[model samples]
Target: MEELMRQQQLSNGQKSERQELTCSVLFTNPKFRADKSSTKDEINSIARMVSNAEDLELDRVFRKVSKNDVEETRSLNRSLFEFGHNFEDADGWLKLEQPCKDQLATVLRYMFESHLKTTVQIEINNMYFNCHFIVLQVYSRFFSELDMIPLLVTLPENAVSQKAFMLSYKWMLSDEPVLELAHLVEVYVAATYLRITSLEAHCWKYFDDEECYNEDTACALYVESKDNPAMDVVRNLMLTRIRKFLLTFVATKEFLDLPTSHLIYLLDSDEICVNTEIELFDGWVTIGTRGKRTFGV
Candidate 1:
């Protein structure tokens, strides 16, 4: 009984040590990923070597692989390889920012107007944008399946608003980029629905920091975000600002001019930091005195 307990304690200590140790693995080979190279056999050999390593438990070897038929798809395929090691952190990566203005603008313009042999159709609210699959796939994973269907047509009927879609499409091709503050929420909703992550991030950053916050913008965002779940992040940001500065927010012309629904929405929020309910009631009367009876609150 004493021996068994001692063995059990030893095993538990080993597990505790293992849990504290971080593990990471990376594999990079310049020639192995070449088209003519035997990558499959190479990966198998590497897996066996890793599994047999003294420091690596055979059961802990993780096998992850991805392959695409380059001959059929005309796209380079690759796999993920692993070897056991503990790595809490590491830093050796370069950040490159290359801005191509004229080159991209010229190509986009040509692609928009040119009669390309291979093209994909993107339809939004009865408006059609016929574009090169190559260019489209670069910016959107949503169009990556074009390798199989060269002439596929995709519609953003329920996903994107018409105005938002048009605006995003135009902004992508514009030589001088322009996205209005008023259309930020709409564009963000459309971008999120389409899974355009970069555009989604850009729109969110704009709303979170770029634009000046006011009652009208907040109310407009509230109205536009009614049925959309993706807009919740930006909506909450606006609500937080409005709540934190309720007194100053109410003093603005935009607040008094708010529609009934928006006012009610603000009043309904428990998070609003008002001194008393009576203060809000007094403001409501002031709005009423301005003859904006449409403001129900």
Candidate 2:
């Protein structure tokens, strides 16, 4: 009986060890599997987000690079055409300095005066100009359409004066062109007729200066440009100036010399101010009397 009891106790201990092993496997297996699956899903989500962000960043970089490349190409093309004296650097590349650039422009102007490689003859107001087709094409849209080589281009009579054309030509060749106030009006008119938009815009900027105009100049400019639709901006600016000094202007020789229509136009503006109605009426009568005297009416 003691032997039987020992065998039974040994069998009971084996059963308890097997039960503990089964319980540990059942509890740990499910938790480990769940943890691995959840970790893998989270890693995949983060990786996808990181990839999208990288794509966006790369796209932005590419667009910026493309824009810079286009701008650099345009700048290079302009530099190729611009007059510059090139000196080889230590690295065997060419570079330019301000003095060298000025010297180059001077040389080119001398060549132009010497009539070297002149491809076209431009006639304006009985004056003739020997010009390079390429140079004219660069400055004027009107010249660009004339594809024929060794041509003679004649401008309409009274379209632009000889002095104005010369000034415009100088402006085209110059690296830095100054529009003197004395010659500004004629040059602006010449640029308009030539279809040189850049020079036209440059001349317009001078009118913004208050010192560029006064009662006399304003009246002259108004009469000079009133008929030109392209010069309407300058015409209107002069009109505004005239109105602002209307009382003082009417006493000036310019107002008395104004055409009958221009005098009426100024007197008709609502913006015109006077100290009294009688003063305004008196100014009008004075202009009318001058007009009648001039015309012997």
Candidate 3:
């Protein structure tokens, strides 16, 4: 019933082709998993991994495309899941599996549709797999597939919002050039975390003596560019909310890999200061905002 309401609200009145394409993405990637892990811990693990971050790497596949495909699609993004999707389970929320699958499909379609690029898809997949695996570890400690309210919020028709968030965050933990992707994940994480998990009593204080980078290092980041634009986006987008999260939960093994108490102290301690005359992450300012957002953080 709730799913139906979401689909109904999505009556954008676009052409039948666009509507069909969006619906088609969902059919293959159904909303619920009949055989979702039964155990509480297993379920949370599934939700956390499945709903970790945005798939920034996946977004890149669509950024550039063949001239012909570009003309045909009208939009550069073969955006499979940007439109609204609704999923709500009042009794007991189920996993938003299809939404994640749909976004993944969108990324795949964009990549393959674009010219034959090198196997960069592997990096995206690796990041996704690792993040899910790690979330599974943490989730296993708690519950199996958490009530997605604690995971990612499903839009009226949006499923990937949660999972894509996980995808984005995974890159933050990754080593740049992969680590560079953290900047993109930064905003998405803050926004999503703020939206979904209003954890008890969060604080935001500037790090007076934080361990930031030197001017030279910042310059090097902007100069260096691997085929990985995902990392580049994250490095480019900077904010305290996202930065602190990555610096705490991601940037360090001492953060996620270590005990939670230890990481809290690490985050709460004095900010690691750094010189930034170069402005590596703070390069170009596109829109009215300081930085843009991707699917992940």
Candidate 4:
């Protein structure tokens, strides 16, 4: 009986030493201290290797005891089970599952949704937004200037519409924000006003895609882009599309609804295609008459 107790005690001592060694290796290992730039796959791979190493160590310990020593084997088995349970509860490995951006986005999203630590309120077209100044300053140069942010700030109704402001707010809180095609132009305008260059760049990428433009959007896009000197690229792209599909665009109500300046701009494009000179002249006359009646000119 004394021999059995001695063996059990030895087993207990070994379990304690093994746990300490595991912890030391886990905490002290350079690979375990995940770098900020490490991908999720890399971090998870490291975690799996560490877990496998721990299992091997436990198995090696179990093999040291004789099969006939039932009590000692049982004690070691119980220790291993308890260790695993405690380790799982610690959740150290589980934390590595999310990449840094995802983890940050999760926390930021929670904070934004909960309205936690909000330092400023922005009003747009009677809609109010509670925002964190720290977060805004990070993404927006307009907000970064100390004098620009105030307790209750109101945006100019002419510059940013309520829906556009709401979408921009969503962009600020998300790692990967989605912009709706319907509001793409408005959101781009808001992003520009806010001086959120990253958001502006993202919007430009959408504009640069030929697939994003079509007959329904092309006329309105041209009207919106024509006056803005900063939107020269977008205006040129619309011109290119109109030139390529002149007859199709001329048939749309949106084309007839174009302002006189915009109609003239389209007429002035030397690259515009038509089946014949007379066909182009008739289309221009129809568009010109519609512009005159609409503008009451």
User: Where is the poorest 10-residue window by lDDT in model 4?
Assistant: 70-79
Worst 10 residues of 2 by lDDT: 71-80
**lDDT string, candidate 3, 1-297, tens digits:** 999887766765456769788887754445446576233343344445555423423333234346677622223343434554434424446653545345785664454344234221112222322123222333232223444423222222122234444443343333331222333233333334324221101111111113333233332232332122433332332222233344232333222233233323323534433234123122211221223323211
Best by lDDT: 4
C-alpha RMSD values across all candidates: 30.5, 22.2, 38.9, 24.1
Which candidate number maximizes TM-score? 4
TM-score per candidate, in order?
Answer: 0.46, 0.54, 0.16, 0.54
lDDT of 2 by residue, 183-239 (tens): 787888788888999998899787776577755567667767877666777877787
Model 2 regions more than 4 Å off: 1-114, 214-216, 223-230, 257-273, 276-282, 286-297
Order of candidates by TM-score, top first?
A: 4, 2, 1, 3
How well does model 2 score by local distance difference test? 0.70
Candidate 3: residue 221 Cα off by (Å):
15
Candidate 3 residue runs with Cα over 4 Å from true position: 1-166, 169-178, 181-297
Return the candidate ranking by lDDT, descending.
Answer: 4, 2, 1, 3
Task: List per-prediction Cα lDDT, in the order shown.
Answer: 0.63, 0.70, 0.34, 0.72
